[model samples]
Target: ISLIKKEIETFISSYNKSLQQKDKNIKISDIKIQKNTLSLNINSQGIFRPHNALLQLKNSISKEFGKKHKLGVREIKINNYDIQFDLEKKPLKNVTIPFADVKFKEKQATISLNNIDEEFLQKNYIDRMINLVNEKVENQYYEGKGEFWKLIWESGEKKPIWTKDPTEEMTKLDWLKQGPTKGKWFFRPQATAILKTMEKIAVEEVLKPLRFQEIIESNLVPFDIWLKTGHLEGMPGEFYYISEPATRDVEKWERFVDLIKITKEVPLEELEKNISTPAAGICYAQCPVIYWSFKGKTISEKSLPVLVYDNTAVSGRYESGGRHGIERVDEFHR
Candidate 1:
């Protein structure tokens, strides 16, 4: 312990001499040693570059001591970057951030970023990660043959249905009309008839033959359900979300009604203010709720293969730019 203390003192004295030459305003004072730990107060009159200076000092100590010591700071100040954090507790301690400059406050932190090579980060990290993900997706999901997907098994076969072209009359039928937003369409009778026929064939011929029972799922599912089903993470920004009114109080509704009566339209700001955080999302895939239905229920081995399918209620998606004819509409039934 005495040797350690003497070594720390010697390093501190050397470091202080360097600081004296370069930054006379910054000084370490009130150095105390207790149980293999050295505590020192840094006084720089708020003008010192806290993060860089502290990191440098810590690195220097590590280099000198060779992992015999570690640096733990109580607080630090940072600049040049905006960082926000929410803490439910006070008197934060033992905070550690690697390769970052940080200023610590009660509930927030500010960070100063060091110069980085953007091209290197893009090429080495981002692009490499994307390429790895694409490789996995192509190898497993797209290229692999599935038991249920007939297209993969029959890809080499030259079927008459595959060569059929749309009739000129069918092409000119104007079977689809644009809806209120992009990626939405109104199907005309001709289109609806074809869709209904397809649905009938799918249910009557394909599903019913396989003893698959029909199940109708709700159009709006809670966000919690989506989270559990992995859709919230997997399909981010792909589904349409919905929220309840901010207040359920009768007085609030009455006030809203009065304002609506006066304006003959919902006040935009008020409307926005009244909408709460997303409580639910419009069903993107009909099967998420179906999986959720089986939660917490133990199915016997006798009920081993439970098959069900949904063919009602249009699922909603926010197709940013990939909208085409009746085939790829945002509001679609499956």
Candidate 2:
């Protein structure tokens, strides 16, 4: 793992020198390696074009590693790429609808629009739309089996509380105000319902007609199992041990820590010596990831490079006060 890290560092150093010659002030912010794949997260400054920079980086990496290794760029931020929406012409007392002006730099487009009363719509129609969408999704996709879809409820086990200790008492509403938990309860229900409706439409309406196989469900597995499979780790957020029972085996814990140290450059030696002490919750997990092309049965040379995807929630201990609505959470479902 360290050797891989050193190779990546060396590649970046060489790439930076090349970029310097081209008068570009950009560098990689982070690098995530899993198996033979490398994901480079870049940070750019001063008129950097993401598409062009990515092409250059890919070329450099190809020159260094050849075709044996896979490389990708993640989270490329382009400066000053802004879009503006505006009303082109005002409506004359409901006689005519206004036109919307969509502008992106020198490019511009216009479209017809209708302005609706938000308060009246919310008071009269929002609930009805929500119910209709929910009903459609429940019957069509879930076959009216609501049990399969868990509602975000006030579970005392997962609630966010104000107290430093878990034993301390707090009101449900008070706990919600602490972070994005409020959004999970208030907004996620409607958002998830709408999302499910779209997904159902795509699968049933679109993909089924095209005869594509539908694998439209999530998997629930143990945390250790997820770690062992190398599905999630080492991008962001702090590590957390949910329960002693889940992580009580000292030998297994040490092995997991050492694996992370090798892959993620974490200081496992210090962490192992101070096992009983907390270290700002920075520890992460490392697992051996089986590539999609190699999963299950062996394939012939003619059937090469199969695609696979794994989507599920994974646990993390995020820094306190880092929560932003449902965008960032302790357990992210993606």
Q: Report lDDT (CA) for all predictions.
A: 0.65, 0.44
Per-model TM-score, in order, reads 0.52, 0.24
Q: Per-residue error at 95 for model 1, in Å? A: 20
List model 1 lDDT by residue over 184-266, tens digit each. Answer: 66667997788799889998999999999988888898989988888886778998888888888877677677888998988
Q: Which segments of candidate 2 are over 4 A away from where they belong? A: 1-189, 201-297, 301-322
Instruction: Output the TM-score of candidate 1.
Output: 0.52
Error of 1 at 234 (Å): 1.7
Candidate No. with top lDDT: 1
RMSD of 2: 23.5
**Positional deviation of residue 260's Cα in model 1 after best superposition, in angstroms:** 5.8
Give the alpha carbon lDDT tens digit for every residue of 1-334 in model 2: 3446778778777776676677566666466666655556554554553335656676676676655455433323322222122222332212211122222222222222233332423343433333333333333444445565668876467655654532122223233233344213232354556556876786678766765542322222334444445444433245554322334667857766776768887665645554453322222321222232244777888865433323332334454666554455554443
Candidate 1 runs further than 4 Å off: 1-152, 155-174, 248-266
